[model samples]
Every structure is written in structure tokens, then in C-alpha cells.
Target: MVEPNFSSGRAAERPDAAVGSAPLAEPAAGAAIDPSKEPEGRKETKHLSRSRLIWRRYWRSAGGKIGLVGLAVILLLALIGPSLALWDYWVVDDNAFLSMPSGDHWFGTNQGGFDVFAMTVEGLRKSLVIGFAVAAIVEILAALIGASAAYFGKKVGMVLQWITDLLLVVPSFLIIAIISQHTAGSKSSTWLLIILLAAFSWMISARVIRAMTLSLVNLDYVTAAKFMSVPSLVVIVKHVIPNVASYLIIDFTLGVVGAIMSETTLSFFGFGVQKPETSLGTLLGDGMASATTSPWIFLFPAGVLVVLLLCVNFVGDALRDAIDPSSKSGGAA
Candidate 1:
């Protein structure tokens, strides 16, 4: 007991030394640390998702803002304007044939005695449907064929390339004109035109997608998926297409403009959306002769078409800038 009292006296003498000592010099190498148990003074960093980043960039663009707002207004007009119109698009107002804008005929009448207001809205609706439908079909076809070609190179890629080249050289406009003229007699000419437009339009987009896929096919995830025995279709769908989706989105927006222009051009030449069911093209064609005499007919539809195309172009440009890493057109993210 006396010896133990000496040891306790020595320990009591070093009490201040223990209190003065530094904490452990370092954590053991590779020691596990729970992030949740981190000190209160430390702060964790957060990251934005890819979609949010792209959206932020898009919203920052002046063109994107204008395009979004304009497109919404146009869509609203197309949907709700018909309900508020004084006269139906197809109804014959013999008494007010080609009349000027008035309380009764707000946007006036065409030679067919149809309301300009009603016809404009209806045409806008049809153009939107055709434009969107064609763009969707083109993108689907381009994605599948292009991704497949690139992933399964060799004979398949060569054949696809050949076909694409052939289509490029072929007179798509003339062929479309011929087919559309023949189909004009049918009630589904508008739908057929969409198919025709999609068929030719996809070749260019497909080639671009194929080029993109070639670059992506050998990437780490793609190679790993192959090593893991993933189905080729699944690999293409899950990996390749998503990588190229940004380009596809840009192409799709531009495709809408192309499709609309194609429809309008065909209709102008008397090969598109036939009688009974009108479109912006048909309105423009009808108004061209009386452009000076009845400026309202030509001016209203033309203005709408111009505005629609401008908005689409704006959105497309913004999307391209936002998605491209090298593009400085989109201001700081």
C-alpha cells in the first residue's frame, strides 16, 4: 500500500502533462470515417444534376426565354382561339366573302368565305401536329438505325452508309412531290407527307448519330456492358442513345422547322394538305394571288408562320449552345 501510494503520487505529478499533450498525431491509415459523424463546423458540398445544369444554361439564354414564351403563346392561341372565333373555319359565309376585319369577322374572310381567324388557328394546329409527328419519327428512326450501325460495324454499317448515300443523292423533293401528288386524293395526305418527310430527313441525322456512336462504342461503360453480356439492344438503348441524346434534342427542334417548311412548300406547289382540311401553306397559296387585294389573309397567316419558325429556331440555337460543352454562346452556367 505504501509503494502504491508512491506510484499514485507520480501519476498525480503528471496530470498537467497529460492535459497539455496534443491529440493523436494522425488518423490510422485508411481508417473508416462516417461522413454523417463529421464535425458540425465542416460543411458538405452539393452538385447540380445534368438536367438541372442544362436547364439553368437554357433559361439564362435570351433566345431561350423569348422562344419559350412565344411558343407557349402560339400553342395557347392554336388551342383556345378556335373556341373564341365568331365563325367556323369550314363554314361558308357567302355574305361576307373576303370581307375585311370586323367585329363579326375579326380577321376577315378568304375567297372560300371561311373565317381567317378560324383558318389561321386550324392551320397552326395542323402544322404543329405534322411538324412534331415528323420530327418524332425521324429521331426514332435515326437513333435506332444509327446506333445499331455504329455498334455492329462491318457489313451492317457499310450497307447503312450506302443506303444513306443513295438517299442523299436521290431527288427527295421530286420524289416527295410525286408521292404527295398521288396521295393528295386521299384523306390522309397530311399523314403521308409526314412519313415522306421523316424518311428523307432521318438519313442526315442518322449519319451524325452514327458518328457519335462510333466515338462512344469503346467507352468504359459501354465496354463493361459488353463484357457483362448485356444485350446489344439494351446496350445501345441504355448507353449509346443517352450519350447522343443532346444532339438528338437539337436535331428534333430543327427538324420541326424543316418539316413545317416542307409541308408549306409542298402545299404552295399544290401537293400538300388538300382541300377541306386547310394548313398555313394552303392559306398562303390562296392568299398569294390576292395578297395586295386582301392583305389580311396573306399577312395574318404569314405572320403566324414567321413567328412559329422564329421561335423554333431560337429554341434550337439555345439548346445547341446549352448542350455543347465548348459553346460559349450560353453564358456562364
Candidate 2:
């Protein structure tokens, strides 16, 4: 409220002493409105977010865009190319396999007459299948074994870790060589080799899980969980697995690549996949023998395998950067 002295005419008429009446003052212009003074109906304006946000920042980064696009294109090819094969190129002698890269037979046929292109597509699928399977098995088994050892600690942990290290250091090729060849006459040869590979391959994942579990075991949440008398399995799953999942994911990708390479090396040495069922490595081996005369056989299969491996590896690298602490600051942004 404003107060004004009105001591002139009105006051005189009222028989009070005649003085002066003062006019009310106006507020200064361009004054800021206080938040407390604002009316209930009026709303403040807000800035908008930028439009088309998905590719905005991505388009600016050359490496990231290249890697991402390459990965996408390669994955699509790996997925769709094999399924849409022009002919059944994976098995046996066919006229198409002998044919050169043309509209009719895409990639030329092998000496025995299997289409290189078709074989390549099928090979990619098979390789991916085995790779993923091995990765999953290794990561899960290793994580379980590793966490248990680390949590238990002492001699048990030391002995298991030692065994893990022993397996980890052995050349994958040499180990695969000995096992695959020795187990060649088994009832289920390919399955046996895959199992053997899985058996020996958990070391790295074990190491990763152990390191993570070691840290988690000392955490306050874990301590509290223990105090609450929670089931060990439940606590491990609820607390430990979630924290280590990112590591498992990254390692799984790598494990896939390793599995592919291991399978290839074994096949090339004439120990894996056998004669009737062919893999990219088997195809490469066949092509290698005739490479001097029939370069297409080796060329296409090898090329596809190389591309597949490269794409998988790049993606794995990017994922690792995205997840791993040491690599996150330089992650695929």
C-alpha cells in the first residue's frame, strides 16, 4: 500500500490545517518482475532441444561414422547374403561352383563344383553360430568359476587361477591341433572339437570375472547383503552379474573372433568340420591347393572371412571402448 499526505483542500474543507496534497508516484520503466510478483496464469518460456538428434553429432565424427557404417553394412551382408544364395552352393559338386563370378553364378565354382559365393554365405552363418555359442559358454562358465574362486579365496583360487593361466598361455592353434587331430575319430568329431575348444577357452573370461568379483566382494553393498543373510547365489546374481555384464559382453565378442580363428586353423589343418561339412577354412584349404590355378576358390572365401573378422573385431574394439573403464574416455562416441 502507498501512503500520501493529503493536507490541502480536502483537509481545509474538513476544518483541518490547510497544507498540500502529494500525487502518487509511478513505478520506474523496464524494471524486472520478481518471481514472487508474477501472476499464477503466466508461464515462463523455455528453450527447445535441437531437432533430428540421432545423426547430428554422429555425422561430424569421421572415425566413428566410418566404423559404425562399416559395421552395419558388413552385418547386413553377413546376415542376408547367405540366405539369398542363388543356388545351393554349400555342398557337393555343382556346375555353378565351377562357374566364374558372373550374373548366373556370382562367385565362380570350385574344382569339385561348389559355388564359392554360396559357400561363403553359408560359411559366414556357420562361423557366426559357432562363435556366438563358444562366446556364451566361455563367458558364463568362466564367470561362474572365476567368481566362486575369487569369493572363496586362498588355495582354491590360486590353483584354479594357475590352471587358467596355463591354458591362457598355450597357443590356441597348438592346443586345437593336438586335440582335434587326436580326437578326429570320435563319434561326433566337430562337436567334440567345439567342446574341447570351449573347455580350454574359458581362461580369459575367468580372469576378467575374477578381477571384477574381487572388487565386488569388498563393496559395501555386498557387505550389507551378506549382513542381511541373503542367499549367496541370489546376492551374486543380483549384485555381481550386473556389474560384470559389460565386461562379459566385450569379452564375448572377442571370444567369438577367437573361436572363428580357432575353428579355421583346425579346419585348415584338416582336423575340423571334416570332409562332408565345409567351413570357410575348409574351403580356403581346398582353394589353397588349387590357388595357383583356381584363385577364385581361395580369393572369395578368404576375402569374406577376412571382411567378417575385420568387421567383428572393429565392432568388438568399439564395444570394448564403450564399456571398459580404461578405454571409455576414448570410447566410440
lDDT (C-alpha, whole model) for all candidates: 0.90, 0.73
The pairs that clash in candidate 1 are: none
Per-residue CA lDDT of candidate 2, range 110-133, in tens?
777777787777776667667777
Model 2 Cα displacement at 170 (Å)? Answer: 6.1
Model 2, residue 288: distance off in Å is 0.5
Clashing residue pairs found in predicted model 2: 94-113, 97-109, 97-110, 97-114, 97-115, 98-109, 99-108
lDDT for model 1 = 0.90
In terms of TM-score, which candidate is strongest? 1
> After superposition, which runs of candidate 2 have C-alpha atoms over 4 Å from their true positions?
1-68, 71-75, 90-97, 169-175, 178-188, 324-333
TM-score for each of the candidates:
0.85, 0.73
In Å, residue 70's CA in model 2 sits off its true spot by 3.9
| Weakest ten-residue segment in model 2 by summed lDDT | 49-58
